[model samples]
Target: MDPPTRSWSIYNRTEITQRYEILERIGSGAYSDVYRARRLSDDLIIALKEIHDYQSAFREIEALEILQKSPNIIVLHEYFWREEEDAVLVLEFLKTDLASVIREAKRNWENGISVGEIKWWMIQILHGLDACHRNSIVHRDLKPANLLISSDVVLKLADFGQSRILLEPGFVTGDEHTHPHEQNTPSQTWMLQQPETIPESDNSNQEQITMSKEEYFKELDDLKAKDSVDETDKETNFNDGDTSCLATYTTSDMEDNPFKSSYSYEAESEGDRSGALTSCVGTRWFRAPELLYGSMDYGQDIDLWSLGCIFAELLSLKPLFPGTSDIDQISRIISTLGNLTEEAWPGCSKLPDYGKISFGKIENPLGLEAYLPNRSSDEIHLVRRLVCYDPASRATAMELLHDKYLNVNPLPVPVNELRVPSTNNGQDESSPGQWRDYKDMDSDSDFEEFGTVDASTTGTGFSIHL
Candidate 1:
């Protein structure tokens, strides 16, 4: 037999390029462990992710190619393979995740959900997802764990391992076709080879074949234009920090094709969509309905569903759907939203996994007011729309970002407030520029703190050793 796969522990120290120091292990995942590191060049904070598999390393690189440009997405500084160990990816470090926030919220209170906090968090995540979808990149896996918040309060969407570029039609999917590096050449064995079965017809919202490519492209273009308008403010970076210079970061440094090709997913069994690349989202708890049934071709809408679930979990401190199995997951959703009727089941028939399933007849309609108490009926109405079981009916990121509930009292955690400059040697490094400090601000504090800090101390902040 071949040698056993080598195991690397997160606690153990791992050397990097004989320069950067691995401060400590911050987090761990199935394929890699994330560590908080200090770059020796400037002693700045950074994250080092070590991936054991060579193939996974390439896939991460491919995903980053399209996703790295957006400010909402986490920044990837560098990536390299070590001759002695495995592949290493350098990233901007983050302190807390949305999952942590949800847990914290649960421990602090013994009552109903915090409507204000929930609304703000939901809007922030939607903004990020909106940016991702606008760029033709889909963060197929968007759960609380993947949303990172730095100590400075910068919210970034992390873990693009399952992300992919939604390809233009008539284009075949492959490793080389998708990745800009051209590391892997085209091979028939690698082509996306889904079964040639006709999709079941849905009388309702089945694939509207008449929707032309031009129309789709136009919609995508409009979305991008809207994001450009949003970014013109030059202040919001989804982080809770304030800085003189904008927090400039990139998700990938793909010098080649930005919008490369489509991803190639291998199949799990026969007759199923083989080679239909899946960004197989986590478990039923975090999965969108479309993902639970197994869709070969899906988009960023899956991320939106996860965002809604995470928002609910933050308020409830429990997963919105804690189903033991896929069927159970569907049951919980149908129970909450009521069984899919012909009105909302337009494209359901076309879905490969939409076979006969047992769902109890609807009795009581799920009232958002009961689930998410104290919120206005209007806001609750919006939340219901967001968490709908039907993917088509679910709120798009753009729509949610501009929702009325977000516009009302307790505005989003201002990006400027999130950036707290580090106090090195008892002096602020980012001072001398009239920057606002967020030292004593509470979780419920709003934009009123933007100009509250003493100007002299923080405005003078700027001490980069580099």
Candidate 2:
């Protein structure tokens, strides 16, 4: 038996000191230290990440290579295995992260981020996810901190250390994993560059303010139809892992209509993709139900789930599902999203951990309006679709941009108007913290370093390994 080979060549610490100068330490985690450094060759300011010698250190290199040309993803320049203790990755440096700007606004003397500004950030985040998924990559960890913002307020996807590139049989790491598509398409460019106009709401007061119960269900059915994965969308072949084999999800797998129960596949078809590279990878609060159910063969829908959770958090300044433990998390999700009945999740009983424990069948309202009282109809509708329980049905990033929720009255605030930490001179700081932010977020940070930890905690950590 042999140990898995890691990426990068050993860089002699003393000889290469002149090439890059470390300016200051920006952040330090249990596994690595992030530094702001200047590349002397051209005086390029790059973020140099030095991680302790471990298989996890090179995850970023693999992810970046696959996503190298994506405008929304952070660019990877140079990488080297430094000594035996670390591997260094040279990456594009951004001014700040969305988490910092969103969470620390009050400390910086700014009002809460306007819904419009949140909308803009949401668009960028989705674009980044689209880039990752287009190449069959899944960013298991998508918390606000991992979403970096440029000086001009452009959001760049960062920290691919926990990312997984979907494979043919199973997942492979390091150089063994060849990328599906390394190039971005002209269509993707056109989609990204499209003028982001916040359209006028087509729904009038009569339409927006009131809807017959029959009309409401009718609209939901219509929305579900719009979200369906049509024949045109399954063009990307997943064999080389370039989006072709989207058959990873069957016709039923992607049947995301809430009116219909969307589970119980008759065994995975040849097109079924089990993305079970690892469970328990995302920040707990934003984790999706499939991950909680221990779905090994999962897909890009998980990222969409987290994106929706982040969207809800931005609006309310509170986590939508702040579950402290796996059981508690499941409970919290059901309490709000309603019971995860076998009817809704067809294969709910088939999951590995499905019968391990039992959860009470507590029923609740399915109306997003009830949860997001002050939010617009479009926002609620979008959230409900994005956070849908059926992975087959979760809204893809591309579908989100055209969602009506974003085009409603009092549209998203523009990028220039976004408040910079040092520049929020006269604004009131109190409003930012007014949202139902958790008083105990410090406690949740305890799980930050447990990204790939073994699922030995039984229920403490929802990490499921087969």
Per-residue lDDT over 105-182 for candidate 2, one digit per residue giving the tens place of the 0 to 100 score: 535435466777778888888878888877678887676656776667777787665566675312233232333432
Where model 2 places Cα greater than 4 Å from the true spot, the runs are: 1-12, 82-85, 105-111, 168-276, 365-367, 408-412, 422-466
Candidate 2 matches the true fold with a TM-score of: 0.65
Please give the lDDT score at residue 245 for candidate 2.
Answer: 10
Q: TM-score, each model?
A: 0.62, 0.65
Best-matching candidate per lDDT: 2
Give the per-residue lDDT of model 1 (tens digit) for 1-466: 2211454532233345455776655444334555666889889888777664333444465455345555566776665543334456777766555654654444445653355656656766776777666655666656665677666565677766556556542232323323221111112121211111222233131122323345544443343332212332322211111100112212221111011111222223211212245534443466777766667667666776777777666655666665544555566677677766656657765565565443445677564455665546766667666687667778887787777877887665555533222311111234411111221211212223233222221232311110
For model 1, the superposed segments whose C-alpha errors exceed 4 Å read 1-15, 82-85, 109-116, 168-275, 367-369, 413-466
Which window of ten consecutive residues has the lowest lDDT sum in model 2? 238-247
Candidate lDDT (C-alpha), each? 0.50, 0.55
lDDT of 2: 0.55
Model 2 residue 62 distance off true place after TM-score fit, in angstroms: 1.2
